[model samples]
Target: MTISLPVTVSPRLSKKASRHLKERFIEFLLFGAAAISVFTTVAIVYVLVKESWNFFQHVPLSDFLFDTQWTPLFDDAHYGIMVLLSGTLTSSAVALVIAIPLGTIIAIYLSEFASFRVREIAKPFLELLGGVPTIVYGYFALTLLTPVLQILFPDLPGFSLLSAGLVMGIMIIPYVSSLSEDAMRAVPMSLREGSYAMGATRFQTAVKVVMPAATSGIASAYILGISRAVGETMILAVAAGMQPNLTFNPTEPGATITSYIVQVALGDLPHGSIGYQTIFAAGLTLMLMTLVFNLIGAWLRKKYREVY
Candidate 1:
């Protein structure tokens, strides 16, 4: 065979090669960014499960689940999750009741009816409301809302689920309204025009065509609102009294799972003690609850997802 000479790369080919290498490098960077979230999630699950497993080994799953009280810090040491769950559910329910309808109405107004000037003015204020510190909301709940509620209902306590939940609802309103408005606004203009062509009013078009087209996004907003309500800590801790009461009545003072965790985490409970381990167990439970809600959200998104 004849001697083979090394092929010389043209300037164009060299540039192309450099560009391809850069593209690969960029792809690797993007993948690393994506993987970071996955890694963090996995690590969190591992730690929670490992610590919670230790907790379960010490405390029977039956008592953890079925006991009526949650006095893990006391000498009696009851570990019923239901008490915390009840408070969480009650507060979340109250928050949802206030948030969903009002958020939806606001979203519809902003997306479909509000003038551009009004929308521009309102959105920044909504964002600012969301940007306010949760601790501030907690104090506001404690100092302001409770007294107002007490005025309305003489029996309402200074630290009540109703006050905490109401404030939480207000706090999460921007989350729901902002996301839902974006989803609604994303609907194609052609759909609105077609509805008008069909003699449908603006309200009708917004309600029927645009809403259906944006169901996936609106559902996502609702899901985010639910997660925010469920996971709220400071507001409940400062205002809901952290009593671990197993009552669904929002008028009563109670502790949510999150508030209890915060209490134990800040307390002088010794490491490896059962009382301390309770936080890990509670953390695991919260993660699972959030996971279930996420799965539900995924299902809703899939079920109502529009091609457009």
Candidate 2:
């Protein structure tokens, strides 16, 4: 008889249900926001594949990959991506060589040795380097670093990979140092104390215990630095000549894939034309190169990340 009556929910229960529904709604919105990134990545890959498929129809894959020259504007256009690939790798290699040691040293100094005041002063200024405009870096490379290199290696060209790479290295120093320093700082103070208890000097503790523990993050920083160098456009475009040369010499002029894309975009090529579409192909190649670097970095991080 008591159950026969129609039951109405209590006001408190209704309010609780409403609040639960609101929480779920907010969660869905957050999930949707995260999903946007995946969608964006998928969109990029789709566009690249679609246009690149059309491009490959006209140009053979072998010539694109293996040919030693990239003359997409020539009467007999060659789609040799190797020329650009070499230049890109050369500058990136140079950037890594300069950035890795210097950035690591800076990170160690900041994390282990620097006074609080020095860390406060230097960290902000170092981060400021990353905020500077790429055009300024380009100009610095063209006018400043190139001149310095010209003094050292008098035979260096006006626009050479060396100058561009050096400036690019300077540009990425903040990325490497900031990340590596943060990783080193994340090491438990107890670990340093333990090292000291074992009769280890500050340098030995930092090099042996902290560095090994922070290897994953340091490796990530290095990979990201290389990625930044490879993807750089303005510095290379302005300082490194637009000529795509397949040489290992760092003092020579060269064009990276990004530079080539920038050069092509500056012109008034019709949409859907071969010249226009070639940029997409180059972009795809650059994307793949960066992807490989990221994959390698990810693998290293996974393999080396410490439980602590």
> Per-candidate TM vs. native?
0.91, 0.93
lDDT of residue 113 for candidate 1? 94
Clashing pairs in 2: none
Span of ten consecutive residues with least summed lDDT in model 1: 10-19
Residue 191: error of model 2 in Å? Answer: 1.4
How accurate locally, in lDDT, is each candidate?
0.94, 0.93
> Best TM-score goes to which candidate?
2
The TM-score that candidate 1 achieves is 0.91
**Model 1: CA > 4 A from native:** 1-34
CA shift at 291, candidate 1, in angstroms? Answer: 0.5
